[model samples]
Target: MVGVSVLEDNLKDESLILGLLDRHPIGVAAVFKRKIVFASKGLARLFGWRREEMIGRSTRIFFSDRASWEAFGERLYRLLEERDDVVLEWPLQKKDGSPIICEIITRRLRPLGDDWIVLSTIRDITAEKRSLRRLKARSSSLRLELSGALEALRREKDFLRRIIDLVPAGIGVWGPKGPVLKNELLRGLLGENIPREIPHLVGRLIRGAGRVFRFEEEIQGRHLLFTLSPIDDQNILLVVEDLTSCVKMREGLETLAQAKASHLLSQERLALMGRLLAGLTHEINTPLTFMKTNIQIFGAYVEGLRRLLEGAELAGEKRKTIDKIISEIRDITKSLEMGAERIAEIITSVKNLGRKESFNEEIDLGQALHEALILTHNKIKHHLRVFINGEPYNRQKGVPLLGVYTTGRRSLLVQMMVILINNAAEAAQRRRVKGATLEINVEDIYPRVVLTFRDNCGGVPEEELSRIFESFYSTKEEGTGLGLYILKEIVNSLEGTLEVECPKEPEGLLFRIVLSGGGGGVERIFNKTFYKGVQDGHQGIGTG
Candidate 1:
């Protein structure tokens, strides 16, 4: 009877221990040979299975796949052989197959025959791990943002430093406590001899009611202008300029003004000569007209004489002599007629020089180029080949479909073109280049027109190009030196810009003229292939 009572008490103690373990927060299980021998209520709740159902079930039921189950078994057994306890985090599955992260701790319970019993405690850590991962990602993002902001600030600082360094005058920035920034010029200007009272003066200026202060000082025989400007309540900007060189510069400018006045006088004389030449051309045109008419009448008289002789009977030698005399007279009349025509063309070209009237006319640049080509034909006929927008120039075609127009005087533009063409011809002749080429391009870039004249006459040296437009500057011995200067003035009067460059290929000078007040008449122009050589074969020029 006493033995039976002891057995009942021991059973009660065992039931009490099991009941306490069932109410624990962690899931607990005991396994033998990879099969669960005992399971607490918490273990069944963790896996969504009843405690009775979990007991005697294989531990594989808690794993989502065979690989994980086998891996865990291998690691667990390997660790158990070395130590009594092992802790790891692994993936587990619920009764519904939902995945979860679990922190598992296992301990060797005891040995039973050939296999060992193990006790395991599992706690779900999915939510905690997710929170940690999110925190790490947010931290990384913040670090990048902070890095970007710092880099931006560094660049801004460098930009400000570069700007201040570029200033010719000494610059300094002062804060409430002391100087916050000083440029290199400022450091050199102040150097060891900086006045002790300057900082005090700045402080006083900062506290004053005025927004700005200016004064002049002489230190170490250097004349300096000082300006203090308040940036805000706590900061002030200081600028120092040395005025010793400025006084000398003013004197130099006065001398330059005198020289410029002399230059202006020369230009005024040139203008007077131009007007005189215009009047001379007008006076000569009257006599030139009469001379051309008389030449034509003389040609008619010679033809009548030849017909009279043809009707008369004469000896063979006498007839031959009379025929030779008639033919010579006819040839002389033709030469006289040609001379009069050439004189007329020269008069017309002179009259067109720098004409200022009709300044508001809508001028077609292509037409102006054609007229200029006619005026310069004699000058370029022998050696030069000219292309208009990459096509050979044809006198008969007359630059058709160019479609580029601008608001300017047609005569003035023609004169400008004439000057440039004559200049290129002279350059080619001077260089004695065989088969020289000049390319003229007119482009309409919307509200602006670009006229380019490029010549392969061996461009001038780079240093000489800048002085080409200066008064009394010429690259040739016989050049009057006023052609390019006058061309530049004409362009300026039309409110346009001119640029000169030396082309790398073809080795020539390129003159680019950009003019405003331009409009396009067609979507495209100059779309044809023009062969070299004139139709009459007199000049190697064409137009398209």
Candidate 2:
């Protein structure tokens, strides 16, 4: 009866323990020789299986694969032999073959002959592990972001420091207690003992009175402008600017401007004097013309009287008297003629001093060239073959093929063109070159007109070319040297540029003239007039 009661008591204890294990939140299982010998209801539910199905099942069935099962078995047995319990986190499979992460704690319950009985508790930790991974990733991202922000802030601070150092003016910042920051300029201006030197100013700034103060002072012989401004309730900004150089520059500029004004006034007076002289010369030319004509007539009369006396039969005294009268008249007339001629030459020499007229006229450069060619035909016809805008010069055509226009006096432009052509022809004659060709091109590069005169007449010496436009600087024996100089003056008056170049390949001189072009409105008017003239069988420059 006693043995029976003890057996019943042992069975009841085992049942009560299994019932408690089943009721536990964690899964519990017992494994002997790598097979489940007992499984709690919690264990079966953890693996998505019935308790009856879990019992007598191999531990490999709970593992995802054979490799994991073997690895777990090796670790489990190795750790069980060395310690009381083994704790591991492993990926396992449920009854549906779905994956789960589990934290397993196994203990060696006892030794059953050659094998050992082990009790294990399993906890599904997939969600917890996933949450922990997310937290780790978030922490790493935040760390990276914070590090980038700090680096950027550091770079920004360095940039601001460099900017502050580069500022030309002295800059200082003051806090409530004392000076907070000072740039290099400020340090050099105030020195290290800034607080002691400017105690009153520092006290005022520290008061943070919301008023701006500005003053100028001479410190160490340097003029400086000081501006004190409140930045906020706790800080003040001070800007110091040195004005010594500025004051000196202003004085210098004022003096220079006065001198420049005086110079311009003198130039204006001189220009006025030149205009007056030109006008006087013009007035003198009118009388000189009549005087010259009268002298020629009187000289002709004297010559006739002398011829008659030589042919007449007369007494010696009468003949001598006639001869004396004729000689006296002839000498007087010759003297008068020579004087008039001298005055005329002087008038021509200073012709450029005269104020230019008809400057408002829009002159067709091509027409100007055509007129100039006609006027100079006698001089250049024999030797020079001129091409106007790439076409052979035809004097009979009257009008050039190209019609580039610019704003200038027609007469002056014609005169300028004449000078260029005559110069080119003379140069060609001097060189004595065969097939001396002169190419005159007009290009309408909008807003400007470019006229190019290229000639195959041996160019001038390099040394002489630079002084070619100087007054009285001539290369020819008979040249007055005023042609190119006057040409330059005319070009300057018309606001144009003249450049001379001597080419090596063709061995000739090139003259490039650039002038403001008559705009589209003027061109349209020109075309209209040109076509109208063509219909009327008239060929010439269009009237404005």
Candidate 3:
């Protein structure tokens, strides 16, 4: 019993390596003077044995021979002698004859008195190690791709900067939240010291994600225009443009256009008045001409009556012809009153034509078309055939998707109609052919009023059609080439555009005028595609 007690004392404490061995999957055995009495469930499984078959047996079965056992023993001895730890990773045999890759850690403890034994822990790390290798490779690939994209973006930024620098206007760009006020023009335009103090504030004001504000800042007596645009959550761009020169140029153009437009409007008004007067005179000619001829006859009769009355008074019988003279004077006064009423009616027509009203009011298109036709009687009377695509107002199939709403500024419409009809008349006159026809069409296209004027005097010349609406772009020998230009200006002021197309096969000019049908279409007029009037050549009449 005393020797056995001493041998047990020399063995590692059961609470230490015994616990690790209890938990370990690989077999662990302790050799005390080569007398093995230790085996766990894992050790039995490792060696293809039951616990009863392995206990009290040496670990020689786990190795091929004494040499292999001796080598493992040397490793364990070194760990025990140095009072340190040892780790080994290698393949271990499973019960089914498969190799399992594992790691083992051995540590020596001084729990036993005068003892030399090691505690070992084993873990299977083959799958875990392989997974780690794959993750590292994927991370390497992603890092490389990110680097390439970043390099390309850097090159693009440089290229963009070079392009921006060449522009005559001031330009500034901010990228995301990276930096603000990154403009080279700031120093050149605003001086170097201006951006030093609050160089970053501009970026913060319009960062990648936020409500944006526009501000105008004057630097060194020049105007700066601020605009913010969001690229995405990751990037926002603030563009600073110098609009001083641009504003000046626009103002100068606007003044000229306004002047020209006003002049043309005046000319149109005078022309309308002249037409009204001419029509009034023609219409009143029956009454006025008769009244004039009557007055001449009455004057001669009055003179003859006066001479006869003088002869009667001389003959003491003047009282006999007084009633005749009185009756003739009454006839003259009644004829003048009838002619004056006709003139009043003519004046009423002119006044109604010049009436100013909202150009945005919802109106019955048929009414407008009728009124326009009546107003253009002088111009369209002998030349053009007006065709309305849809039926009369009350007979409309329904409230059209695009309703004819009259936002009637009738004067403007009258002017455009005048110009169009006059042009058609002139075309017909030039053709000198009785069958040369002009057709004017109007339709409601849901948020747009489409008015197309086509002429059988044949289409305008291909190149000339584009210029026909340009200010001073006239083929006429008339006073100013401002008629069609002003007509387009008036149409555009009503938020409309006039498009001219001479279809290659169609043999005539088609002038299409698209106006906002009093809805969201007002913006469409500015799209350049929607309006074909008033292009690059602006004779400085910058009505736009």
Best by TM-score: 1
> In candidate 2, what are the lDDT values of residues 1-544, reduced to their tens digit?
3222322433335544555556555687777788777777878888899977776778888988899999988887998889876779899999899999988888765566697777777867786676967644543343333222322223244323333443346866666677766777888876753433344565675585446667777767677777666655566667777778878889889977976686578679978998788788889989999998988888887888788879899999998888888888888887788667656655653463244757677766665675577567778889899987787776545545455678977767777788889888998888798999999888888889998889998888899989999865798898767789989998888899999999987888899989888457445645765676777876554211
Please provide, for model 3 over 327-390, each residue's C-alpha lDDT reduced to its tens digit, 9 standing for 90 to 100.
6776775566555544444444455566556765545443344445444556554655544454
TM-score of each: 0.46, 0.34, 0.33
Q: What stretches of model 2 exceed 4 Å from their correct place?
A: 1-356, 521-526, 538-544
lDDT of 1 by residue, 1-544 (tens): 3222332433335454455447555687777789876777878888899977776678999999999999999999999999987878899999999999988888775676687777677767676687967644543343333223322233245434433453446777676787777777888777656665567767876787676677777766777777776665666777777776776788789977976887789879988998898888889999899999999888888898888988999999999999999889888987788678667756765665556667788776765776688789888888688998889886555564477778877777887898889888988888998779999998988899999999999998988978999866788888757789989999998889999999878888899999975553463222211122233332322222
Q: What is the C-alpha lDDT of each candidate?
A: 0.73, 0.72, 0.55
Question: What is the Cα-based TM-score of model 2?
Answer: 0.34
Who is ahead in TM-score, 2 or 3?
Answer: 2
Select the stronger candidate by TM-score from 1 and 2.
Answer: 1
Models sorted by TM-score, best on top: 1, 2, 3
Candidate 1's TM-score reads 0.46
lDDT winner: 1
Candidate 1's C-alpha runs over 4 A off are: 1-244, 354-356, 364-367, 370-405, 429-435, 442-449, 460-486, 516-544
